[model samples]
Target: MKDTGRFFTVGLVAAWYSSNIGVLLLNKYLLSSYGFKYPVFLTMCHMTACSLLSYIAIAWMKMVPMQTIRSRVQFFKISALSLIFCASVVSGNISLKYLPVSFNQAIGATTPFFTAVFAYLMTFKREAWLTYISLIPVVTGVIIASGGEPSFQLFGFIMCVGATAARALKSVLQGILLSSEGEKLNSMNLLLYMAPVAVIFLLPAALVMEENVVGITIALARDDIKIVWYLIFNSALSYFVNLTNFLVTKHTSALTLQVLGNAKGAVAVVVSILIFRNPVSVTGMLGYSLTVIGVVLYSEAKKRSK
Candidate 1:
């Protein structure tokens, strides 16, 4: 039984890594190289896919017990989370349109710094002094990386940073809004609800902001049928990314997830660079390395403090 459990966990971790990296690379391909410059609409597609898949998993397939919001307050809390999730995902897709995945991942590595800031401001949660100090390199590395990035765009950098901060904020807000035992939902259940709410919010925004994105996508499909297949595969991967992430967290500790996340970012950077042929300067590499090292240190500090 122990050996079987360990193997299952290893499989889940592998799936999590592959799906996470796959979704990111495909998002970059679709938005940047493939000329699908409709990030809001693309994000909407992702949410739509998640909504449908989560329903099938929980309702039809019985992956977990079906769950529903128990009160208006819980529904409102989920709505707030959905809004932040939309912002984070859309901004991230938009950033990929103008930035290399390597640079984007480097910017994303600073999520812990923002998470700490938001936690302190919103929840009055304070970490150990060592954990606070460890974030210095996380910020400094991004600044140094920005200076060295060869194809840096100001707008892309800003969007990427915004996405990172929004992600952190969502994490903090999730803790605050859903901390109550009665309100708490499992990750899959939370996603099942949040995905549909996100779609509800994203639909109008994409229609207004993206300006004929639907028509453009249809036209692209006519030109190459492969575009439709690419989108289907990409959207499916997005759902799997979330699913595997939840499974990994369920099976292992949050600290283990954090450590795997750090390694995943590094692996993603290398894979994206190789696949996209994005030029990386020595300074940029050094800065990214520094940021990753700082994150590892921060994780260690948190573990010791606990």
Candidate 2:
């Protein structure tokens, strides 16, 4: 049993990267080439899928052991996190529609900086000065990358930055909301609660912002079943991304998870460039490389401070 659990944990890490990259590319394909043109509706599908699959994992599979919010306050707190989650994903998808995945991933590398700033503001937590200084290269690299990006779009860049900030805020809020030992919910449990709430939050916006989702879905269904399959796969992978995030942190330390996140960002950028055949200037690549290196150093700084 111990060996099986270890193997599962390692596999979950792989699943995390696979799903993360897969969903990014799939969403790009769908929104760009496949002509989905409805980021909000697509996000709704993802949340619905996550909510259902997570429910099954808890109720039937008993994958992570069931957990429930004990009070209305806790429920509302989780719901607030759910709102942030929805905004992050919606903005990310919208950004992907306009920006190359490589650039998108490059911008995402600044998440740690945003996380640090939010943590200090929201939680009154302080880190070593070196930790803050390390972010200099992180911000500079992103600026260089943006300047050098051949396919940069102003709107896409703004949305991507928004997504990153929302993600950072979610991380800090999660820490505060779930800080108490008795109230802490495991990843799976949190997803189960959050995904459904996010769906509810997104539905009204999707309806208001998107055009004829039913008609578009039917058109795609008739024209190409492949698109529908991709949507399903994308949603399933989205849930796995959440699941593996929890599993990884359960089996390893937060620092290890952060390290993996850094690697994953680098891998996704390289893979996207290669797959999409996006033209990246030497300066841009160097900038992105510096950003990644800065992230690694920042992680190290945090570790040493701890």
Candidate 3:
């Protein structure tokens, strides 16, 4: 049984890493190179795919049992989560528009720091001094990396930071809002509710911000239908990311997921640099190294403390 559990956990981690990296690369290609310049609309497409696929998995395939929001309060809580999800995905995609995947991921390495800060602020929970102190290098490393980044754009950096912070906030808020066993929605069910709500929320925003942009994409796609296929594949990969994340978390531990996430950032940077030929200065590499080391240290600190 232990061996079986270990094998399953390993498989889940592999799936999570592959799907996460795949989604990032696909989104970067679609948004930047594929001429699908509408990030918000692209986000809506991702949400739509997730919503549809999740419904099928739950209702038709019977892969997971259906779960419904039990009350108005739960609905509102889940809605808030959906809003955060929308903000994170859209902003992250927008950042990818102007930023190299390497730099965007380097910036994303600050998620743990943001998560700690948000946890303290929102829950009034205190952490060990070491945990707080360990994050100093994490912040400093990202700043150094940003300074040394050749492709750094202010708008992209800002959006990436916002996405990172929103992601952290979502993690904290999800824990607090879904603490009750009876009221808690499993990851797949949560995705089902959250994705649709997010799509509804993003509809007007996408129309206002990206409707014309999408129209332009459609016109461009007529000459090259590859654009449409890229968008569809990208959206499908986004759903795969959600599915893998849930499977990994459900089968393993959150700590395992966090550790894998840290590794994924490094993997993303390496893959992006190799595939996209992103130029990185020695100082930038050093800075990214520092940030990753700090994150690993912080994770260890949190684990030991617990």
Best by lDDT: 1
| Regions of model 3 farther than 4 Å from truth | 1-9
Best by TM-score: 1
Better of 1 and 3 by TM-score: 1
lDDT of 1 by residue, 1-306 (tens): 999999999999999999999999999999999888999999999999999999999999999898779999999999999999999999999999999999999999999999999999998999999999999999999989999999799999999999999999999999999999999999889999999999999999999998988998999999999989988999999999999998999899988999999999999999999999999999999999999999999999989999
lDDT of each: 0.95, 0.91, 0.90
TM-score of model 2 (CA atoms)? 0.95
Looking at candidate 2, the ten consecutive residues that score lowest on lDDT are 207-216
lDDT of 3 at 30: 81
lDDT over C-alpha atoms for residue 120 of model 2: 92
Give per-residue CA lDDT, model 3, range 1-306, as digits (tens).
Answer: 999989988888887888889889988988887767888998999999999999998999987899988899999999999999899999999999999998898889999899999999999998899999889889999999988999989999999999999999999999999999878888899999999999999889988987576678778789988888887888888998988888887876778777888888999899988888978988888889999999999998999889
lDDT of 2 by residue, 66-162 (tens): 9868999999999999999999999999998999999999899999999999999987899999999999999999999999999999999999999
TM-score for each model: 0.98, 0.95, 0.95
Query: Model 1: which ten-residue window has the lowest total lDDT?
Result: 61-70
Task: Supply the TM-score for candidate 1.
Answer: 0.98
